[model samples]
Target: MSPQLLSLVTLWAAAALYAIAMVAWSIRLSRVADERIQARQGAGAASSTTAEAAAPAKERVAVGGGDDAAVAAMASGATSFVVDDGDETDLPRRSGADRALGAARAAMYSGLLLHLVGLIARGLDSGHVPWSNMYEYTITGSFVAVAVFGIVQARRDWTFLGAGVTGFATIALGIGLTVLYAESTGLRPALQSFWLVIHVAIAIISTGVFIVAAVATTLQLLQYERTDGERELTGGAIRRLGIRVRNGLARWTQRATWFEAIPSAQKLEAVAFRLNAVGFVLWTFTVMAGAVWAEHAWGRYWGWDPKEVWSFVIWVLYAAYLHARTTQGWLGRRSAWLSIAAFVALIMNFTVVNLFFQGLHTYA
Candidate 1:
């Protein structure tokens, strides 16, 4: 096979591996949640029996200072309990969760290697930067997303994000291979400049960062709402669809304990804010570089092009998100919603603006 075909094969292989990783992570979360539910149920049952049968022996049990009194006290909500952290051999279920997490991490690492190899092969075959069109952009963007996730994982135990990051990469690769796939071809005249590499690369990187932040923001919003035990997922059809998508991984999202495993909503919001801050800075430079490139190619620094307009809209939305968050002291929910809106705008610029709107940035 040609290098291009081999690249395609590897890219698809990577996507499959990512999908497997996503499934594994989902199972990990699900198993953890299931075990927690069972434990809680068992504790509740034991406590109820203790509370019901404590009349005659209550004084004696309390005087004896035994496990029965402790159970009765905990059942009655009269005592505080601290869970013991013991050897892993004591909990077979926890050991299973660890194994699932290990498998997910291994699969993600393998997929990342294949993804990088595919991108390198595509670049070698095209004799230029591989991200000249939508197909190439999706592949490169997803690669960056996985790479960022890997780096974060290496530094910390970000296993909570494993399913989300890998799922995004898999979906993006599938879409690229289907709707956005194109033949390996040379760059168009307007893209025949070194600026294409610099400007677009930064933009792709920023977009990848934004994608990660978006996932965090989304989870934060969900967890924030779920903090109230009475809170339910309610909305119109589209909102229901989003909830359904999240609920598909029944293990990861079905239980409140799963959310508890991650950082608190405030901490998640802080992380998302930091990520968006970096993306915003890079995107600002992306706009400036685009203007410079436009001046060189189109003989003007500014035009009312559709892509430019939407790009500016994204910047403005994110800018407002930051301003409202920092200056106005917007709460977590509001800030997270603004972040989602900004990402939605970014998605529109890439999809709707490229396909429907007529503009100089029709290369997609």
Candidate 2:
């Protein structure tokens, strides 16, 4: 088979693997949720027993029948109640859940490897970079996202994000293969320069990181919404309906229990913040590099092109998000919303602007 055909086949295989990984990760998450629920129930039962035993001692102390030593002993015993550290290594293993997690991770790695092979084949066929068009860009972007996730997972157990990452990869690959497939072609004159390698490559990497950050922020927002409690709705019927729908979804998520397997809102926020910070730095360089390349190619540093405008808009949104998060103390749900808004703008810049809007950067 031709390199292009091989690349296509491998890409399809990668997508299939990612889909399998998503399912396995989801199963593992469900199992984890069940374990967390049971642990909470056990802790609750233990706490109730302790409270019952302490009631008489509390009454004796209140009646001045308990000596200082007795009160001290009760306090010491109360303090001795140890919180579970969540370490399950010593407990009997659930082989099915462990296998699911292991299988998910293995699939992720295998899919990523196949994705790399496909990209390499594409690059060989195109005789340049593999990301010169929308189809290639989509595939490459998803690959980078998964690569970033893998890199982070190596240092910490970020398996909670496995389902989201694989799900996104599968969807992106499906879109690339179906809607945006393109023949291997030589680069346009404007894209022939080395600047295309530097500018667009950095943009792709930053966008990938931003995708992961968006997922983290989305989780943070969901967890925060569930924990934030209910609020009265005061609006028109349509607006109230929307609010009611949102509240219903939050309530359903609260019942899912798998959400408990995810990190707390605070930790998710921190992870999102770090990811966004890295993405922002890379994106800042992307914009700067794009300007330098534009000056070299078009004899101008800045233009009011639709692509350039949207890129700048994305940069501004993320900049604002970071500034608000760091300086203005917009930490929890507010910061997550802002991060998500910036990500939405980034997606629009890539999809809507590229397809619908005309610009000098309309190579796709």
Clashes of 1: 1
What RMSD does each model have against the real structure?
Answer: 7.3, 8.4
Candidate 2 has an lDDT of 0.88
lDDT of 1 at 218: 80
Model 2, stretches more than 4 Å misplaced?
A: 46-95
Mind giving the per-residue lDDT tens digits that candidate 2 earns over 1-364? 9999999999999999999999999999988888878879978877878866555444324224435554555654543222223443344446666889889989999999999999999999999999898999999999999999989988987788889988999999999999999999999999999988999899999989998888888888788778865656878998888778778877877788789789998999999999999999999999999999989999999989999998999999999999998899987878888899999999998899999998887885
lDDT at 108, model 1: 92
lDDT of 1 by residue, 1-364 (tens): 8879889999999999999999998888766776677778978887788856555434423323355645666656554543333322333344667888889989999999999999999999998998999999999999998898789778876677778989999999999998999888988999999999988999999999898888889878767656633324699988888666555544344354656456678878987898899899999999999899999999999998999899899999999999999999997788899999999999998999999998899986
Model 1 segments more than 4 A misplaced: 34-94, 229-257
**What TM-score does each of the candidates earn?**
0.79, 0.86
Best by lDDT: 2
Evaluate all candidate structures by whole-model CA lDDT and list the values in order. 0.84, 0.88
User: With candidate 2 superimposed using the best TM-score fit, by how many Å does residue 357's alpha carbon deviate from the native?
Assistant: 0.8
| Cα shift from native, residue 247, model 2 (Å) | 1.3
